[model samples]
Target: MTTHITGTREEWLAARLELLNAEKELTRRSDELSRRRQELPWVRVDKEYKFETEEGSASLADLFRGRSQLLVYHFMFGPDYKAGCVSCSAIADGFNGIAVHLANHDVTLSAVSRASLAKLLAYRRRMGWTFPWASSGDGRFNFDFNVAFTEEQQREGAVEYNFQRAGHAMDATPVPLPVAQSAAMTGTDATTYSLDRPGLSAFVLEDGVVYHTYSAYARGLDGLWGMYQWLDRAPKGRNETGIWFRRHDEYDRR
Candidate 1:
């Protein structure tokens, strides 16, 4: 005897064909991303910043660590935070192998954060990550690049430049603008706070100078965010769900 099924063979086969179309679409899209990664639109770095590496203090350019192309994962561990964001934490989990292989292509990758060296080291040890993680604790590399929010930038309206707080308290609630009826709220305003974009940014070293290449945010980084997707995109999607939460047993919240 065979297990009963709901649909006809033709219907089942058609359904699978639809899934194949989706998978192929995603494959083409992924390949396009790979092409985009070949090289980024370059921008020259005008200001020099600093970071603390295991070797010791180094300039922003030095984070390249003698590599030609650099890709920095802006991990979200704020200056005062005790830990990194779980989303970012998950991404770092898959960075192990890529760390070694990317070097073969003259490309280098590192996780950059504002956490102090001691804190970064402790956390890296706990995560068992082998990638080179650096601390930009004393520098404005983060703030300048719009990846780390600083209290000063918030007050100065450098980011989240909302006008509602023109004369209001930073702690005061915002008064919705009457004009909002005509315009969709930008989710943030002049008075809103800026958390900076904690994602990926690339650079290339030319004539011994680092040039800002490109950056991405949110789902845009689904490609290199981890290896589970890369592995799942193979012949079979995956044996199990690819998501997990704080604990190894608990599933991550959708």
Candidate 2:
């Protein structure tokens, strides 16, 4: 009852070899893109953004933690939400494993959210994550990075996200079913949950000044989602029809 094409071992090896060449070419292109990303002009960050960490209140520069480079995952955990975004949690599950390696290489990887430090810490403990998570509670850091929006922006029907003005789920009159479901999971309303979006931003500290290097949002974050990277190479690829993922802890219970 197998629906897939049946192939002999010899035929499969020949096709796989052909695919290997294409994969190698893609790897080379990815390397070139990495070089271009590094070449992008750096914008100086003068705003005095503050975040509440497990240690204490810290400024934006202090986020680097004495490292020259800082990579921040803009986790979607708004002040109103009781929990983090499921999709974001899925992405963050991989952070702990690579965080120490990045730190050893002089890069500090952290997650920043609008949730309170206590809330973040509670969720971090539940997930058993050791990586640094900071709360931008009542701070402009998330808004400045375009990862968090305001009620006014939502009512206006379009918000600048992923570097472009686009319609947000919060703007939907009835609120999309998926958004409602995700909001409920976060223990918030759709409008409130939609205010926070997922993104990653890079910053560098040079000569006692912090500089913005780059940022990526939405699908741009796919590369960092390890599960998707693995699924991409699977026989069926990412065969998703709807929101089928959950926070890692929720999976066993489901």
Candidate 3:
């Protein structure tokens, strides 16, 4: 009684072959886009941003960690939050696996957050992640990168996120359900949680100078979320409802 299509072997092969052609075309397009991304102009970073890492304090350049390139995952863990954003945690679960590979390729991968070093370390330990994570709690690094915002920005309704001035969830009188859920999971209210957004930033150190190479926010980060990449190839392609994910540890309990 299943409503799904039931076809002969030959029919299935024909349909799959048609889909294969489209997939190949998409792959070529993705490659070209990547080439264009690398060609984008780099902006020099002059700000003396500092971060609290496990090895005492570190500078933005030091994050390169003897590598020429740095890829920072701007994790959504605000100073006030009790936990990291669940979605961000999900994305971060893949980081530890790839961190060593990227380091060997001369690119250092890291996660930066506004949470305190102690808090970050505690959560990282709970998750059993070995990747380098830094706390930007006392620095303008997160704000400068457009990943973190202030209360004033939320109140004034002048926040520019995802490359445009959009109405933030923090500004909404009644917080949206997804934002509320995420906030509660982070052990914060909607407003405090909304102050932090998810993003990825790329940097390069050349001639003793750090250059901002590229950044992606919101859906632009989808390509890097390993789980979703697999789900996209599944039969139902990210068949999502409202906030269906949890921090990896929470899933088993649920």
Top TM-score hit: 3
**Model 1 global lDDT (CA atoms, 0 to 1):** 0.68
Residues 169-234, candidate 3: write the lDDT tens digits.
545677788888889999998988999999999999999999999999988999888999999989
- For candidate 2, write residues 171-219 as lDDT tens digits: 4678788788888889998888989999999999999999999999988
Q: Which pairs in model 2 have colliding backbones?
A: none
Better of 1 and 2 by TM-score: 2
TM-score of 3: 0.96
Model 1 per-residue lDDT at 6: 68
Ranking of predictions according to lDDT: 3, 2, 1
lDDT of 1 by residue, 130-190 (tens): 7998998868887666566656756665443122232323233353332221111222332
TM-score against truth, every candidate:
0.71, 0.94, 0.96
Report each candidate's C-alpha RMSD, comma-separated, in the order given: 8.8, 1.7, 1.6
Off by over 4 Å in 2: 167-174
Our model 1 lands, by Cα RMSD against the true structure, at 8.8
